[model samples]
Target: MSTLEPIQVGLSNALLAPERPLPPGVITWNGSDPSVRFDVYRNNVVVSLTTALAEGFPVTRALVGERFFAAMARCFIADHLPSSPILSDYGDALPDFIAAFPPAQGLSYLPDLARLERARVQAYHAADAPALTAQDLACQLANPQRLSAARLALHPACIVLVSEHAIVSLWAAHQGQGRIEDVDLRRAESALVLRDGDAVLVLPLSLEIGHFLVALAAGAPLGEAAEIAAAAGPDVDLTQAIVLLIHYGGIAAWHTPGDL
Candidate 1:
C-alpha cells in the first residue's frame, strides 16, 4: 500500500465520525487551529449526506419528523458512508437501518416505506428500453403452445414491492391522492413501480398479481407464473395481469423456446 493510504483512510473515517479528532496532516494555509476548520468540514459532510437521505426518503422523513429523522440519519451515516459518489444511490441500506433503529421500532411500516421510496429512485434512474406494445405481444404470442411457454422480459424500471403495511395508500396519501386518516395502517398492500416515459408511477396490485409479476420478472414461463399467482389467491386472473402489463408498458420483450 502507498504511505498515504492510512492517512486517506483516517481522513475518510474522521469525516463521518464527529467524535474522532482531526486526522493528522490536515492543515490550513495559515498557522491556525485545524480543529475548528476540520469540525466545519465534518459538519458539512454530515449535513450533506443527511440532506441526501432526506431527499431520497421524504415520506420516511415526514413520518418521523425532521428532528428525529436528522438524528437517525446521523446515526446511520456514522456507521454507513457512501460507497458510491452518486448521492441518489447513497441510502439503499437505509430501509434496513430504519428496521433496526431502536427509536423507530414502533413504526413498523417505516422501513418498507423507505424501501418503496428507494425503489422509486431506482426506477427513475434505470436504463431506458422500448416497451413491448400490445400489438407486439399479440403477434408474438398468437400460438397457444408458444404463449404457454413464453417468458417475459419486464421493463428495466419495473419493481414489485409487497409489504405487510398499506405502503401504497400511505405513499399516495402523502402525494395528495387520498386522505391519510382514511388509510388503514394494518392492511397489507403491494406496489408495482415502473417508469412510463419520464414519469415514475406506482400502481397498487393484488397479492396474486404481485406474485405473478414477481414470477414473470424472475424469468418464469407464463403458464408457471399463472400457477404461482393461483396458489397465492383464488381464481387468479391471468388475463387481467397480462392486460395490466401491456397497458402500463411493463413488458419489454417476450420469447418462447422456438424464438430462442
Candidate 2:
C-alpha cells in the first residue's frame, strides 16, 4: 500500500461513524479545525445514503414511519456502504438487515416487504429485451412433445417473489390500490414483477403459479415446471400461467431441444 492508503482507510472508516474522531491529514482551505468540516461531510454522506434507501424502499419506509426508518437506515448505513457508485444499486442487503434488526423483529412482514421493494428497484434497472408475442409463443409450442421439452427465457426485468406475509397486498395498499386495514398480515402472497415498456408492474400470483415461475426462472423445462407447480397445489392451471406470461410479455424467447 502507498503512504496515503492508511489515510484513505481511516477516512472511510470514520465517514459513516459520527463517534470516531476526524481522520488525520484531512485539511480545509482555511486551515482551521477539521473536526467540524469532517462532521458536516459525514452527515451529508449519511443523509444522502439514507435518502437513497428511502426512495428505493418507499413502501418499507411508510410502514415504519419516517423517524423509525431513519434510525434503522442509519444503523444499516454504518455497516453496509455502497459497493457500486449507482445509487439504485445500493441497499440490496437491506432486506436481510431488517430480518436481523432487533427493533424491526416485531413486524415480521417488513423484511419481505423490503425484499419486494428491492426487487422492484432491480427490475426497474434491468436490461431491456424484446418480449415474445402471443402468436410467437403459440407457434413455438405448437407440438405437444416439443412443448413438454421446451425451455423459456424470461425478460431480464422479470422477477418473482414469494413470501409468507401479504407483501403484494401490503405494497399495493400503500400505492392506494386498497386499504391497509383490509389486508391480512398473516396471509401468504406471491408476486410477479415485470417491466412493461417504462412501467414496472407488480402482479399477484397464486402459490402454485409462484412455484411454476420460480422453477421456470431456474431453467426447468415447461413440463417439469408444471409438475412442480402441481406438487405445490393440485389445481395448478398451466394454461392460465402461460396466458399470464404471454399477456405480460414475460417470455423473452423459447428454445426447443434442437435449439438448445
Candidate 3:
C-alpha cells in the first residue's frame, strides 16, 4: 500500500466505526485527547448521512418510527458508505438493504415503498426531455398497422414499477392524496413514475398495462407489447393505456423496426 493509503483507510474507518481507534496523527491543542474530537466528528458525519436517508425515504421512516429508522440507517451507512461525492446519489442501495434487513421483515411492503422513493429521487435528477405529444403519436401511428412494428421511446425520467403489494396506494396515502383506510393491502399495484417540469408524478397502472409498459421499456415493438398486455389479462384496456401514456408525457419518440 502507498504511504497515504493507510491514513485514508484509517480515517474512513474512524469516521464510520466509532469502535475503531483514531489514526496515528498525534497533533492536538495542548496535547488534549483525540478520541473525543474524533467521536464528535464521527457522530456528525453519521447524523448527516442518517438525515439524508430519512429525507430520501420519508414514508419508510414514517412507517417505522423515527428511532427505528435511524438505527437501520446507521447500520446501512456502516456497511455501505457513499462512494460518490454527491449526496443526492447516496442511498441508492437502501431499497435492497431494506429488503434484506432483519428489523424491516415485518414490514413486507417497505422495500417496494423504498423503491418508489428511490425512483422519485432518480426522476428528480434525471436529464430532461421534451415529452412526445398526442399529435406526435397520431402522426407516428397514422398507419395503425405500423404501430405493432414500431418501438416507442419513453421519457428519460420514466420508471415503471411492479410490486406484489398495493404500494402505489400506500405511497399516495402517505402523500395525502388517498386514504389508507380505503386501501386493500392484499391487492397488487403497478406504477408509472415520471418527471415533467419540476414535479415528479406517480400514476397507478393496471397490471396488464404495467406489463405492456415493461415490455415497451425493454424495447419491444408496440404490437408485441400490446400482445403481452393482452395475454396478461382479458381487460387490458389498450386504448386507455395508450391515452394515459400520451397524456402523461411518457413517450419521447418512436420509430418502426425498419426505420433503422
By summed lDDT, which 10 consecutive residues of candidate 3 come out lowest? 136-145
Task: Provide the lDDT at 182 for model 3.
Answer: 88
Model 3 gets an lDDT of: 0.87
Which residue pairs in candidate 3 collide?
Answer: 148-223
Ordered list by lDDT, greatest first = 2, 1, 3
TM-score per candidate, in order? Answer: 0.92, 0.93, 0.93
The lDDT of model 2 is 0.90
What is the lDDT, from 0 to 100, of the residue 59 in candidate 2?
95
Once fitted onto the true fold, the runs of candidate 3 whose alpha carbons sit more than 4 angstroms away are: 1-3
- Give lDDT per model, in order: 0.89, 0.90, 0.87
Q: Model 1, 97-145: lDDT tens per residue? A: 9999999999999999999999999999998888888778677645777
lDDT by residue (tens digit), candidate 3, 159-199: 99988899999999998978988878788889999886789
Give the winner by lDDT.
Answer: 2
RMSD, every candidate, angstroms? 2.0, 1.9, 1.9
Better of 1 and 3 by lDDT: 1
